[model samples]
Target: MVAERTSRYNFTPGPVPFVVSGGEGVFLHTTDGRKVLDGAGGAIVANIGYGRPEIAEAAKQALTGMGYVAPLWPTENRLRLIERILDRWVPAAAGEAGLTRCFLVSGGSESVDTAMRVARQYQVAKGRTERWRVAGRATSYHGATIATLSVANHDRRRQPFGPMLADHPKIDPISTEAAIKDLEAANPETLAAVILEPIVGSSGAALISESDYWSTVRQFCTDHDILLIADEVMTAYGRTGTRMGFEHFGPAPDVLVGGKGLGGGYAAIGAVLAKEFVAEALAEVGDSIMFFTFSGLEVSVAIADRVLQILEDEDLVNRAAKMGAVLRARLEEEFADHPHVGDIRGLGLMQGLELVKDREAGTTFGGALTPAIIGEAFKRDCWIYPAGSARVPDGMMFGPAFIISESEIDQLVSITRESIDAAVAGLQS
Candidate 1:
């Protein structure tokens, strides 16, 4: 007999594995002939859902004409995509006041990296040479790069690399209120920018600054001459029902970064949208380039342009809002009475479940319980995101594509409720 080897492990140290062959619409067909609903859209990137023929055709046509181009050279696809993004975010009412320039990148991580770099450079261009430290909130995820890792507050992800990245850049983890005070107290000369995810993704789907938080932060940044960078990698492209998460807030930032669904999970694309002042400051520095790559290729831009068009024409953003409300209502109705479920909250389609260990005391279920629930959920054939560090504890997040159907949403809700029960029962036993 031959030793058995499976294709893909389902995120747990288990005997069984799930091997997926293809996906269309909101359903994933496994190699074992099982079709599981994609509950979380593979970390919320598939906003337009899987297998978009329009995006495919656009990619094919662009490849046939001009497959690749250096980032330094201008291309029609890149130009059109930039215009589309600008049209969506920068309204005629503002007239180029919100975002003045765009820098293209490969993905979410690169988008964060570029924003950090641009912010740092902007400070330098303005003769604020001492301002190098970047600030981010506790538990918010930026990226995996050295600089981004410094900014992100995930202990598990940063622990191994902390020693190596400690001195690379200065990062402060502070609450919205404390951040303002600390910045005011710090050598104001040393602060470059404050980077944050408007609605926190990962780290248990934590959200900060509901209404006035953003407005207050924006005012503080403006008052102190600091740059504000909204890292919208997960929240942009209609994931949050809005075109961008910052729109939910009052004021715009000095720089805005978006990726993930920007290309609708088709092309590897990310972008940095800079305010006119930031762009003008960078321009004054005399040819200071932030990113250089071949990935500003024509094919990616063409595919991304079509993806944006589909999002607009199909009214996927509005659909996400409606479907999100339905899913949340259904979950609230089912699990609101469950003693172990502590909280369920989110914006748009980005939802979460934070389980409690002691229902009476409202104590959280951390450590083994989280992994156990995720493990059981995988066994049940649901692909929701189990996110958080040990510090946050017992978090399961869901952000299905905007194109997810009502049936898919209900299926996801049913399976999630079942999985939670299974995990709770096992714990009690």
Candidate 2:
């Protein structure tokens, strides 16, 4: 183990810090030679396993061929990647929604911020300048940027910056009626768009909504001329057994934002996909769209393109679906009756265990039990993501690489069960 040290400039140090030397497949190796299972895939980002030589080679080739290019200029790599995302990777459901244009960015936060700006621009182009407010789910998370944080409802992330954020209306994630009520109260005329996670992540792990809820929300947005934005940063690219998370529901979003698995942690990349009508509206009002300096950089685009190719060649999307079932089934069988486990929910590779003080009474631990649980899991040579807030209280998230085997899944579950018991015992002690 490494000793804790503080630096004058270090701002966001982790609770338990360790030095990692390298990773291969689904395990991370520490500098001191300890192997830990990457249960959460580093914040649920690595859909594909680590140490992929092909991806490295692709990036190298791109760097050698075209060192750098400005965002304004188009490159072959960027065009090819856009083509793959539009013609090959996009789900049929998203295609039906008329998503035909792509705007590349650096990461989830930038993608979300850009999407919000695009929504505002679209409304303005349609002569609805009064539509400026955007509604987000009360328990959902979009990203860390100012614009994204303003619209998102993550309590802890928004607590310190409350005064600086816009007072956007927050709707319930699970109830369409609550959303309708809030929208009505906010006055639909003032609302430009509504952003959703389809399957909520971070604040709540893989929290899913009913199909009817999505359908109703979609209808309401369409009827009122409010654009619907789907934040698929954590749920897209085979994480939920679908290319896009919104495909799980009946209706589709007018704009979709994706990150994380898009580059499989091999490159920093994200994209905002707009429907044909939405893009056309923006086109009508020329010079409304802006670009980031690093948007659609050649090397990153090449790496992302190769990642998509690997996913298709190995049929890893289907593997995620099959292995996800195995993982969820094993977790349920092991933890469903555990004393401290309140609920086990999620889709595909993204799963979460809600912890509670009294499972029968549906009571939460009410404090900071998540950090303790995460610490215990680390002690057991496993890395699991901890999720909690004022809304959710406590949860443990899991999103291993799609290549995880049956035996590895069993091992992960066993460690989690033991860690949960150990954590709860520590709390009592």
Candidate 3:
């Protein structure tokens, strides 16, 4: 069995949990002959589903051609991907040019690094040496890099690296007035950029601020000459129903960072999109952003191109909106009255549920509640994304593939209900 074959490479020589041999649509085929429903779409990625032959063909075609062009040179796939994103995916609300500059990288961390550095560079190019800090939301998360972790405020992820990270100022997560106060306290002149997720994901379980908060923050950043950046790493490319998360409200951001769903789980690709002015500011000073060695790999670019086209051709973005409503209704039906379920939040296909000790008291059951609930789901051949950290410590996210059906959504929610109950019961005992 392929499951047994994995033991040969375990180093320690032991049987492990079931290994995924393949995936199709909404399910992962395990080596143990189990069809595990991928409720979280592999860490809330996977937009169009898996085992796409078209993506493989696009990648193979690119690989057969000139495979390793230096990122500085614009290859065919690289050019095509940029055109597609700017013309189709970048939100129209961003104006005529609509985030005119696109920078590609290998993955999310690199993308965040590129964005943060670009923001800093833009400031330096404009002779704003005093503008060195980037203000982030109190509960927001950017990525894995030390620089990103420093700008972000996930308490658990930042705990170990506290000594190394520069202390970036943090603003109130949901209140415009409090956020303004935080910004004033941070000394606005020191801020180069303000980075945040339009809809908080992993660290806050799809949390969204009051609608006015985004617009107010945008104006605040503008008034202070601070570049406002929307970190769309998890909410871009139709994951949140709209083409982008910021579309829910607010004027266009100066910079937008994207990842995960950009390649639809087909390739390791990420992007940073900047408004024309931001690029012009750096270019006027003859400064150029650094590129990673593997930035915009032709194979990855080709695969991402196909994924975007697939989303457009099949109208999957709209499907996400309709299916998101279905998902929310299903979750409400199953968990609204459950004692341990505290709150439901999210948009499009990226919904989340918060777990608490008692809904009436709003008391938390701290410690390993998320992992325990996840373990229960896994036992029944389902996989849900574990989410929440810091202030909101126990929550889970349901970000299934855009192509997921009503039946699949029902099954996934049912499994969630069973899993939550089983875990809660075990905790009670």
Candidate 4:
């Protein structure tokens, strides 16, 4: 028998414990033949779950019709998807999630890249060209590309590329009051826009902002003439039980960047939804026409169209809402007695469990705690994302597929409880 080389792939696979081969519902099959329940949906990207026949068929049909087309030219699928998206969000929000126009891109990084360009262009169009700095929230993730990386708060993700990042202002995520103070101190005149994940995803799944906080920030941006961008790449498309995360807020964002579940992980796609005013600014004074070759191709667009239809037909968004409540309730019931499980918070399918060392004192777990818990969980064939700082406590963020059932939801909560028990027991022993 001919022997193949045993050299393995060395790329980092985020916070996952193993390589996933396939998934059905919320269960993922790893290459090592382990079927682990996907509690976090692979960074909250797979909302629809794995192995969908309809989505597969849509992609196949597009391939048969026409494989690829550039955005410089027009295509039928692109036009249809754009019309469909505008029709859905525009009427629903009464112009609150004001994205009357859609600009497609390859993925989330490209979407954020376009967002930065659009922000700077908006400033230039309004004749505030000197407003060059981009302000981003600490611990929020935009993307991995250079400009987006510059604005991104994932320390580990950005450390290697630190030298090349463009100069931008950063605000700590302590409070909206503190953010305002920092922004003012960092030359508010030069600031073009402030971007944030309506719900923080990466850093401990921190859902610290209150209901009025977003509205206050929106008003502040308006008074200061800085564009507000809602980076819904992780929280959009029913992840938060709404069409958009900003729907939970008071004022609409000037730009809404969505990608992760935009195509439901069936295709690589992202889009920037801009207000009519932002579109007009681009039309009037912006010289650069943003275009990516595979941004709005036939296959990706067809998949997107079907994904939206499925979301509506199946009423999965509502499912996310119902399941989220059950999951949260179960967590509270199961882990209420546990000393390590500090706090649990989320919206819809997006939920997080902060594991601390002591409940009475609220002391956080150190760096060693995460790997121990994650390893123990993997042995049980359960995959959950572990995040947070050593200085602070650790937490697990979970946003399972919207189509998840009550049994599966219970399983998730049970597995987490088991993982926690095993970890704690090991430490105590």
Candidate 5:
């Protein structure tokens, strides 16, 4: 059994959570000697899985050998990582659009903030100084940072900071017509950029946009001269079975931000990839983008490079696609007739299960139901992500490691079924 401990901190406002002893592949070993399946891949971050010795070694080497360098200065690991991203990782559509410049940052939030800044700077350089507002989708999350929160529309996350957030226009994620109306209402001339997640994460797990909607939005942005920023922090680096989620759609975004799977949980790192025109405008303006203090750290970059190598060598991206099919099939087979299962949708390994009170009417369960499901799943030795919003009232998300075996997938499904049943039973009781 695990020893209990107390903490002065109250991040969760309860007793300290279980201590994680270690992890191997897709399972997390707790101090209590329970091997819990990392169903959500620790918030969908561990793409390459746990206990990767090669990545650890690369980090060690960089830390011991090169130590530190100013973030603005170039280093061997940083340069190699940039080359890898440009030559191997970035989507073909982005490359064709001349998105060749990369700006490294500490994590997802910083990457998004940097992308926003780049968009504004590009507009300024083009003498469109009045263009400063950014528009985002209503059921989306960019990051926890103030600027990202300002542009994002997640109700719960933004509620506390409403006064602090900038009143950016928000549009419906699925409706291109609504976006057009909102953009026109907000005035195109005052808008610097339009930011969106190719596949919505956190706020509404893996909420994918239709291809036609994406095509329409891309054209509208082009016609209006608004820079398009793709927040691929959760969907980039092969999480969506593609090199980048935007590839599944048309016309690459003017600026792309990536994180989460970029380092595969090996290190805290993120990057902003910009088209040549955007970078050129910034360059011509003679104002370089400022760097994060820990941006391009040798060790972090080295670890990220090694993680990328592992992804390519293992072909984990393709694996994600194949396994995602298997997972979707299994889920449909098990839950298609389930009374509480309303919708199961997503692409690649990123999937969401929307629970409902009335399937025929498409009504959602109460908000508390999702947390109860999360608790039930945790009790059953699986850790799935809970996602909810005004639209997606009760849902759970899953994006396990790409390396998870078929047997593990079976186990995951079994546990999920059991957990859902248990949670529903409890609600009835």
Candidate 6:
């Protein structure tokens, strides 16, 4: 029955996984009575954990008070969420002339698409209508939308949409000199923006470029008048300990994209924020952004505002930083010597565990290792997010809720180790 129902709605063809009945705190309850720890926070969402009664109350009030409103208009919840992000969350954390404007959308893809459009629009508003290209790193995942897919270079995801995607110039992900050369070759006058992730998530398994690289890129973007956009969908709002992932390094991007954590898995909401000058240029032209009808749903904004308030009142951001240290220590202590585990790297709670055929030989088993390992982990009552691209072959992301306890961390690590071993044994046999 569970298999039939799951297969009916989901697009994926599969032997159905167990039905998730409910979730509380850091654990998910199965319909069959199996309780599993949430290791990946439901695709790296769930900052405040699960089953919070406060979220329910907030949702009820929002729907009962004033239901639906158009995107352009401002209601109490919309105003509150905008004020919260502008005044408390992003203002200071964003670079010198901080972000002064934001647009709310449904999810990561929409948020990314909005940023891409704004970049193009910014150029058009400034009379640089010829600049339409948005450069991005060779291996990155902004979102699933067509425009975002065109800007990013995740091979597998873009395979089917090759002909439809715009051929934006690409740059090296790590090398500063190569990246600079690539930028110059892209022809500054024709490029409008450059999109990047603070730490490469799915495409590179939380890859962190040196601080110098980010600083250099910032200067290069500034020199060329190309806006730098940071896609923080998977690393913002307490996931990276800091408010924004870029805070770990130097200056902030001209445009910042965020989602998932904003609503803490309670609502589907995303935001694309821009520096003051970018918005002013568009406003000066008396131009505006096109809004998606469900841009800022009354219920969603209410839930998101309530969620951010909870994150603040409970000090979960600081807790994420503190607990992230403990999670890192546990991962290091456990997987440092494991052969299948090649590397462990990340900031705050968003850590990536790399997989290899053999760590000593620096060999990889391509992308096959990830699914095998993930399958094993699921059997052990843990679900971790599989992370990789065609370029970055195999790995998994471990992003639990900020409220996760030390003992829960222990179980997660232990289960992961055992799952890796089991998968390896199965492969050998």
Across 106-125, the per-residue lDDT of candidate 3 in tens digits comes to 88888888988988999899
* Ranking of all predicted structures according to lDDT, beginning with the best and ending with the worst: 3, 6, 2, 5, 4, 1
| Model 5 CA lDDT for position 105 | 95
Candidate 2: C-alpha lDDT? 0.87
Answer with 2 or 4, whichever has the higher lDDT.
2
Clashes by residue pair, model 3: none
lDDT per residue for candidate 5 within 1-429, as digits (tens), equals 122343444455432246788999999998888888988889788999999889879988898857679998888889999999998988776788798999999899999999999888889999999999999998889999999999988788888997899878988887778777888898989999999898888887677766677778788889988999999998999987898988888889989999899989889999999999888888997978988889987888999999999999999999999888888898998899998888788888888888887788876667767888878877877889888677777888889999988889899988999988988888878
Q: lDDT by residue for model 1 over 112-186, one digit each (tens)?
A: 888888888888898888888777776678888887888878777888886776432322332556666656665
Clashing residue pairs in candidate 6 are: none
Clashes of each: 0, 0, 0, 0, 0, 0
Once fitted onto the true fold, the runs of candidate 1 whose alpha carbons sit more than 4 angstroms away are 1-16, 91-96, 167-176
RMSD of 2: 1.4
For residues 1-429, could you state the per-residue lDDT of candidate 6 as single tens digits?
A: 777887777788553368888999999999999888899899899999999999999999999958779899989889999999888888475745768788999989999899988999999999999999999999899988889899898887889999999989998887888888999999989999998898999888888876687889999889988899989999888798998888887788999989999999999999989999999999999988898999999999999999999999999999999989999999999999888888899988999988888877888878887888888988888988889886668888989999999999999999989888888888778
* Model 4 agreement with the true structure over 1-429: per-residue lDDT tens digits: 001122244354334456668888788887878888888787788888888899988888888857667675667778878887888744366365556878888789899889888999989988998997889877667888889989867776677887899878888665778888878887879999999888877664645575666877788788998989889898888888888887877668888889988898888899888888888887787455478767786788889888888888899888888888888888889877777877788888888877888889876656556667777777788877776642234777888889888898888888888888888778778
Model 2: per-residue Cα lDDT over 83-130, one tens digit each: 999998788777876888899999999999998999899899999998
lDDT of 6 at 94: 75
lDDT of 6: 0.89
- Which regions in candidate 3 have their CA more than 4 angstroms from the true location? 1-16
Predicted structure 4: lDDT: 0.79
- The runs of at least 3 residues in candidate 4 whose Cα sits more than 4 Å from the true structure, single-residue gaps closed, are 1-7, 12-19, 30-33, 94-97, 389-393, 425-429
- The global C-alpha lDDT for each of the candidates, from Candidate 1 onward, is 0.77, 0.87, 0.89, 0.79, 0.87, 0.89
List ranges where model 2 is wrong by over 4 Å. Answer: 4-9
lDDT of 6 at 138: 93
